[model samples]
Target chain A: MNKMTRQFEGYSFIGLWIIGFMAFSLGPLLFSLIISFFKWSLLDKPVFIGLKNYIDMFKLDPLFWKSLKVTFTYAVVSVPLGLIVSLLLAILLNLKLKGMGIFRTLFYLPSVITGVAAAVLWMWVLQPDFGILNYFLSFLGIQGPDWLGDPNWALTSLIMMSVWGSGGGIVIFLAGLQNIPQLLYDVSSIDGATKFRQFRAITIPMITPSIFFNLIMGVIGAFRTFTQGYVMTNGGPLNSTYFYALYIYNKAFQDLQMGYAAALSWILFIIIAVLTLLVFKTSSSWVYYETERKG
Target chain B: MNIFGKSVTYAFLIISSFVFIIPFIWMVSTSLKEPGAIFAFPPQWIPDPFLFQNYKSAWTIAPFQQFLENTVTIVVLTTIGTVISSSIVAFGFARLVFRGRNVWFAILLASMMIPYEVTIIPLYVEFKLLGWIDTLRCLIVPSFFGAAFNIFLLRQYFLTIPYDLDEAAIIDGCSTFQVYWRIMLPIVAPALVTVAIFQVMNAWTDFMGPLIFLNDQRNYTLTLGLNLFRNSYLTEWNNLMAIASLVTVVPLIIFFIGQKYLIGGIAASGIKG
Candidate 1:
């Protein structure tokens, strides 16, 4: 047999065995779609409402809009800033300087920490009264805001808490940096390309794929962010930090609106799908393809 | 290289390092502090008198013994489930030729795009109907099936494994499953460790899953229990810091020690974002 046919023959078992995985992974997801279409109350039989849940959320619900606004604001402000920050750190970290490994590990340490720990720790730091943050500020003769308790600062505080342990992005960026061949740097240097130019031309283009990956994943990940919001703020300070996921969580578990929650899930699904498509659409301009496209 | 560039790198590195280390250093320091100085600033780097009593305080506040037990048990189960199921499914996707393979694989790939949070509501209702709330089953069941990400990882790694290895195993009269157990699994040790560590770390630090499913309090995992201690009050700073420190630091210490393994495994696995 030819290489293609042999490879095909080799992969033939996946056809049969994937059934078990498909059943479990896809079963609940399919069930979710059915639940999304109905007014499922668990206690009673679900009533089919078609797309009423979507309609209600778009035109009727008050909290949904607020949650959407808060979540979108977070995604926009944080993603690009985080990308730039982490990429800069990745470049510095990629340096051949001594003790850089220690620095790398120290930076990466934050990501391994549970979100709960960081959230709790920040609650103390952001505390306006008797907090170490405020105490330090008093030395400078300035007062600190009640970060978690203030409506305006609440979401921003949550964002700060989110970025506190953002080392995973750095790890990916570092790995991407490693993939850029040394020759690129060598040739650019021979041409007397300045350090800034080398970085702009060499570092940026080569890491475009990872940057695209991180951006898409970052947005998707941001939308699903719940731990800090659930732990630190509990969607409080007049619901300024009330994220979409948190709102869905409250609707399902707290208020027993399973149908509404499922509906919310589908809504989130649509949003993410559209967003993913948008990223891919825009990626043609920025994302570097390594291989020639058959098309 | 410009002197300015070098100094700027150092400047950024130093300040960023401080930002990273403060919470960790404070966590350890406060754990060793007396109750009176828990929040005192310049946040006394050295507690006036080192207290071993904080450990005792942290232990007594919750059924942490049960929390530890539950956390360990669930993590072990999930790790085993993820390893076995993911590898099995990955092999099928990786090695076998089956009908509608592209369609099924595409379905699995599509599942990766749908965020895990999207399924929580249906899962909750499904589990509630099955009366699995507060049970460890709720925690492990979802992961027991091959996750799309893991399956994708294993498939990618398996693709890299030479076809010659499987052919040689088959020539020795090995069944497909035996070839998998004897040849495939062994060769994929690095990938397995990578996945195992990922599972362990995720299970160790996961607060949201246990917080939602585990309602009995006795069934609380380390992360949830630590959250409870911290969230209890503004004044219970000593107990809060001590307990939170204990739980958060445990897995981190383990990861720190195995940092080489984690860094190596992550690089080797080449996991998709």
Candidate 2:
């Protein structure tokens, strides 16, 4: 410990920051918890209702199951597909060649686009009649499905959009690719390993850590998806794309069932948390942590 | 490494790149299209008689300028609050030897698990009580407290800065505040930038916050504006797309203009936990 010649005793920066943080966050955080217990809409004062709202959501919310189904369905389908595409894109962009920076920039550009904009752009493209998709389909004498307008295809349409704006994951994949030892690749080349074989042997094993990272993050992100549903379809032609977050949102905010929404939110959080823990537990078998060997 | 494999790689990259770029390219082209040709049976890559009136009309239908102002006001305040709040909190967790520091930090980490859904009910009621609903305060205030994720993310960077800086400053009769403000802050500038960029983008593009909190039409953000377009003009293809294009993509395009800074920011944040 050192003696201070003149301690600045007048102001407390830490206190100011805490005061600021709590001033803004505490009300919302605490208020939300308080409201989760009572049943109230914006019109009337919230009345104490105990666990009735919670019970009702779990037992009776019709759209609850449907929303869960749609969300998990999208998550299950999109996560692996996105992971592979990002990895493949990262591998290509990491090549020893000229103008790769341009390619990298191009691939990452779509991700930064707001989800609303992407939805709007794709809405035009995916419009069944008079849209570009059908026009292309007509050229091949194949008709395109009604994307958002069709109940059956709306969720899938959103899934396709999720895969498109995957620049964030692609960046992480590129970082993982860069961390690979060049000596391993060079040695494999000397052994006359085919590109596919080398990728299987060296690249895949080496990038397991990144794979685990993306897998966990992808699951969490997928579970929390509400933007596309809000933007593109409003959960759809017939609630086809209504995800868990959107469902809780509609129940609490739109429909004004506060307690029920809290219950729903808790359920979704638990499901996601469990899914994350599962991934973490499973990773021990496949994941290659860099420091584990030394320990 | 083989020549044939290299060609295959190039082909995959070129084709996939085209697929990814198509919607963005088409969005720009369609925004400029005349009313008659917005969704012409055959998709037109080039708009004939490129009408820029859609932009003007779109602006009128939805107050793009007003929405821009509202969004900017909210985003700027939130980012400033976030930078001021999160970095200091991160500093406390990174350097302080206070009782319950570990416990409080753990609580912060745990809060990250509690999604927006869990907190929406009480917040809505509280906002109503505080007279915050339909105001920019509702949008900006919740974020000022420093998100758990941001605190954790920045704390990771803060921990990696050499403690020698703090020790030397202490020897020079510097207080903890002086050590934080003068000695340690400069080294973590990139992480601060990263935090700033993330908060800016999140606040700027945020839909749910504005959607729930803002009831007044004038306060709607770009996200809420886009949703309004879908609801109101369900059929007016060209104008809506034009407005959506500018509102949604423009901020990101502008944000990334200094692209190297963002990359450097991420790398700086990457060195720690």
Please give, for residues B52-154, the per-residue lDDT of candidate 2 as tens digits: 8888888887676888899889888988888877887788888766555676677666666666665666676777889998999987876666767777777
lDDT of 2 at B86: 82
The list of candidate 2 runs beyond 4 A from truth reads: A1-37, A45-49, A190-194, B264-273
Instruction: Give the Cα-based TM-score of candidate 2 against the true structure.
Output: 0.91
By DockQ, the best candidate is 1
Cα shift from native, residue B199, model 1 (Å): 0.6
TM-score on 0 to 1 scale for chain A of candidate 1: 0.89
DockQ of each: 0.49, 0.46
The most accurate candidate by lDDT is 1
Give fnat of each prediction, in order.
0.46, 0.43
Per-candidate TM-score against the hidden true structure: 0.92, 0.91
**lDDT per residue as tens, model 1, A1-295:** 3667655654544533455445444666678788878887678889999988878988999999999999999998878878887888888899987789888988888777666777777776777865666776788998878988999988887777567667777888888888888988899899999988998887887788778878888899889888878988889889898999999889888887777888887788889989998998998887765563335
